[model samples]
Target: MSHSVAEHEPAEVTESGNANGAGIDLKWLSDRVEYGLYQDCVHCGLCTASCPTYVMTGDENDSPRGRIYLMRAVVDGRASVTEKVRHHLGLCLDCRACETACPSGVQYGKLIEPFKVALEISADGDDRPPLLLRILLRHLFPYANRMKWALIPARIGMKTGLIPIARSLGLTKLLPKTLQRMEEMLPPSMPLLPPAPLPEKLEPVGKKRATVALFTGCVTDAMTPETNSATARILQHNGCEVHVVAGQACCGAVSYHSGDENGAKAFMRANLNAFDLSKYDAVIINAAGCGAMLKDYAHLMHHDPEAARAAAFTAKVKDITEFLVELGPVKPANRVEAKLTYHDACHLCHGQQIRNQPRQLLGMIEGLSIVPLEETEICCGAAGTYNLSQPEMSRRLGRRKAEYIDATGASVVAVANIGCQMQIRYYLDERGGSHEVVHPVELLDRAYGPLPGGTA
Candidate 1:
């Protein structure tokens, strides 16, 4: 839990054992920071082709390869954590699409996380929000009970017409646009029911073929419980016993992305204690952000001896699409008839290196034609709180994303993350068009039968 500045070392390039044929040799001090990871880069610019920020800003500094160069410079003591460096680094979506395209298989996400941590330590001024905002974001948002208490007031204000009145009076425009979007994106107040705790193990409904544990993430539980219920139903119908653990909280992705290492670690430990990993064939994370985080537990717990055991447990964690794909074909029901477009959540596609599973799963559903959206791999600018913190850029990205979705002429936009869903929903609403932004599981759920609380 103790964070300290990294010790400075003499300027010298360190070489990795495999760097002889791998290209560049990393320096010794750089090795401790895993600067060797960048040595594998051939600078072929393949990463630039897939980089969302690069596509958006057309700036080399905003590209993945460019950021790696900046990181390499810092590692070699050739660069300082200056404002320009920090700005370029901060602009990265950390979407990890670059890794998918890199033939060298550079570990971009892992490399960037440490670089961010080091940057935060080296930076001069505090980049974090006000004290109260920081406390609320770090503590309350990640905790279920506290989040419910906070949502209550927001929900009450929205239901009482205060939010609409304020907007009409031009009061909300005075507030930050991110706050305005948050107000507009609020779904109708739904009942906040506790997650259903499943038995340690479950026998598959029909053939008892596979057993899976579902990690119904924090926001999904409170904001979109239908996704969780639908996931459970779909899995169960497909001869899988679904175990839903109640104690699982946020995947710590939000805090980790914001440089709140302590908050992230605490949530990581709590999640580790919440489930028994060996019991299920695979840990199913429906939310793309949480899915990506679960897969990286080993790297996150690399420094903690006590949490290492739990980290190993996380090695088996799988996104729902990945898990379902591994289970082979499910008997297709001829119920899904809607034409839809699939928006790849950055975490699922790039972060976790899962690109085909969702598409494959969608293909299995009968009567559903998958129309490809333009720039499907680009970030929707909902990188955790990136939309809230950098509203202008977020809005720009969201509008671009909306245009792509609109071009497809699809009635439904299916995505895997709650944040992306909310952001996309906001853009669609602003355009004065009618299109439902839904989770892929919700679409699948509709294929199986009517959802628990009726179809939306």
Candidate 2:
């Protein structure tokens, strides 16, 4: 994990100046993208030793130092994003393990995101998504309402034995295994509901310590509205007024990560319009992915004046665990003692740099024995759309995660992200394991009392 430092200094590039100045500036793009990494690296290669992909592949191309070298070459016009470069970039989980390991304090996450965006744009029309599949994915999967509507047919197909018949007839197997897995992973038909609308304003249950607006994210709202309900109850119990803003749609992290800048911005604007920023002391998000997006709105909305203002307003957003940890002295109820292992959601642990807060909160509950999950920070291969796009890899990662959870011998596996929950649950069910996937908030709600609807 060590490399000799080269003494030759690279020429500095200004933000507005292009290497060739032919309407495209590699230097400018790199300067803007790699803001904090310019002079920081001393070439110790410590980050390479910590990268998971590097650990698995044992290739320099898969390591952080290698990626940095590629980025530098791209900026200096010594390289174009060939298939090799793209493959290396694609392999990254963006888990940010390198950030924690870097003594020079490189901002690897920020540097990599913009690079991904640039690579995606450069590929542009040449890398057009599969026509029929693209339409379905872009239009259907990302929209919560559409996804809910589509789930109905899937449920009907499954319940009426059509899905099994199709599989029996080898029809479904004709499709990619990822699609088949997605179809299989869907829960048995349940009543789907829209997010609960915001009251004009909710008064704090006890003395009003603070007023926080809640973002009922798309996936969480459509698939598991109970998590939001639990969040509202917890917030109210902790002396905060909770407002469930209706207008906020998907946080657009999926689209953003997948290189759909237009869609991501559109969602950001919708979110701004949905939640009134001036009224609440903080914007609270239970979903780690959405929380990360809300927290980074300031940078996301930098291009537009009004949206920038809205983003500024959203700068105070906090993940529920972070907020709860800060709100000290809440009483814990002794109920439903169970052995549990906690899965660190990539977005929560790596994206938000929040590792201990969820563990700390769950530790306070009586009768809950928390066991450590092996490779807790590894991606569950549920990086928003990764499971859908890279099914084989996703399955490999998911199975690895499931085996680790099983080794802990915990009946309940607790996690904070919906993506990880679904990914892990799918693998657990596939393996015929008895373990149940549960959200930390749900456990807390159960400890407090029977949930509002008497449903688990």
Candidate 3:
């Protein structure tokens, strides 16, 4: 298929879905996505080798170049937003693997994210996310406090072994498809109660090299609180004063990716007002997805008056490993002698171009063995809420990842994102493998020492 799209013909569109037009103001796409981003694709097909959907489906429409063609065609009046077109676009993981693969430096996220927002607004009733999922994604997932309440039942089930009994009796099959996927992905060892909050301020263990603010994420903070606390303790151990900024909220990734653009901006704006950027040397994020979103805030609101402030904020954002490596980490004295393989979270590796800092941090652990897992950079089918939306494909990729992890014979798999952690854990459990998935900093914290004040 030809990848290049002709210039959009605005004269052809009408206000209604008449014989004259599809009622789509395709010109609006020009506002959200620059036309040059579409033209950047040369259609060399190099990206197809890296795309998770294309690799799985072996369909041209599922490939990055093909999706670009479809999106550009729709904008240029060569095509319409048909169900088939939505299927091709919706199947995408938005993991940005294609961006890393493209020689032309095609900004695929700039193209696809706007298109997702457009589809969510314009799609027919049956084509949108289900009502319950809408509530969960928009209402519950972005709110850490709300999510803790929601997980209470699951925590109880896991604590009492009722979850295992329920699965044995096929009782889990009765849940809504989304809930079933959520249930499947819940880590078995979740605590009976929600995790404790990070202290307002943690003093540096010695002379402070840097004062940093921690962006404890919404889903990540609720799901893996230890990792958040570990991140704080690790920063402190490395001679950085860590502060959990108050009134902070989600990074707007969950809402933005789920197609609530206005709501996402609201969250972003709230964060802008919350964090006093001058006091901290840098803003630290442990989760790659949140880091990428926080870093891209400047681009997301380029036209607004607050764009300059967003850009300034973005300048200070860094992933925990990236910051620690740049800050010259203290050599860990304690030994954690576990053979582990690292799974590169898509957002960290591709979205943020962070491939080696994590491995570098892991290398410092005194007695750790680092083995290369096959297909380490491949998406593990947990691109944000992807497990809920595309469970079948999610499972396929999850199982595929699990197989590679198993082949390594490593007892543990370390990942940098909450979504990847949960998805990998679920699939490894399904395949009856006993691999433990953990954040890299958790190990670093273990090697360093315990927190100064108390346990989180």
Best by TM-score: 3
Error of 2 at 369 (Å): 1.0
Tell me the lDDT of candidate 1. Answer: 0.73
Window of ten residues with lowest summed lDDT in model 3 = 8-17
| Colliding pairs, model 3 | none
Global fold similarity of model 2 (TM-score): 0.86
How well is each residue in 1-456 modelled by candidate 3, as lDDT tens digits? 223223312222221123334325566567878898899988787888899998898777788988888777777666677777778888999999999999999999999988987887777688988888888999999999899888999999999999989999999999998888888888889899996798899888878899999999988888899999989999988888899999999999989988788899999999898889999999999999999999999999898889999999999999999999999999887999999999999999999999889999999998899999988988999999988988889889999999999999999899999999999998898889888899999989899988566433
Runs in model 1 lying further than 4 Å from the true structure: 1-32, 123-126, 130-133, 174-178, 188-204, 332-334, 450-456
Across residues 371-433, which tens digit of lDDT does each residue of candidate 1 receive? 999889888888777776667778888988998899999988999998899889888877875
Assess every candidate by TM-score: 0.86, 0.86, 0.95
The whole-model C-alpha lDDT of candidate 2 against the native structure comes to 0.72
In model 2, the number of clashes is 0
Pitting candidate 2 against candidate 3, the one with the higher lDDT is: 3
| lDDT tens digits, residue span 135-247, model 2 | 65567666777776667677668678787799779898787654676775665444434454445455555577888888878777667777888877777767788887776
Clashes within 3 Å, all models in order: 4, 0, 0
Candidate number that wins on lDDT, 1 or 3 = 3
Provide the lowest-lDDT 10-residue window in model 2: 7-16
Top-down TM-score ranking: 3, 2, 1
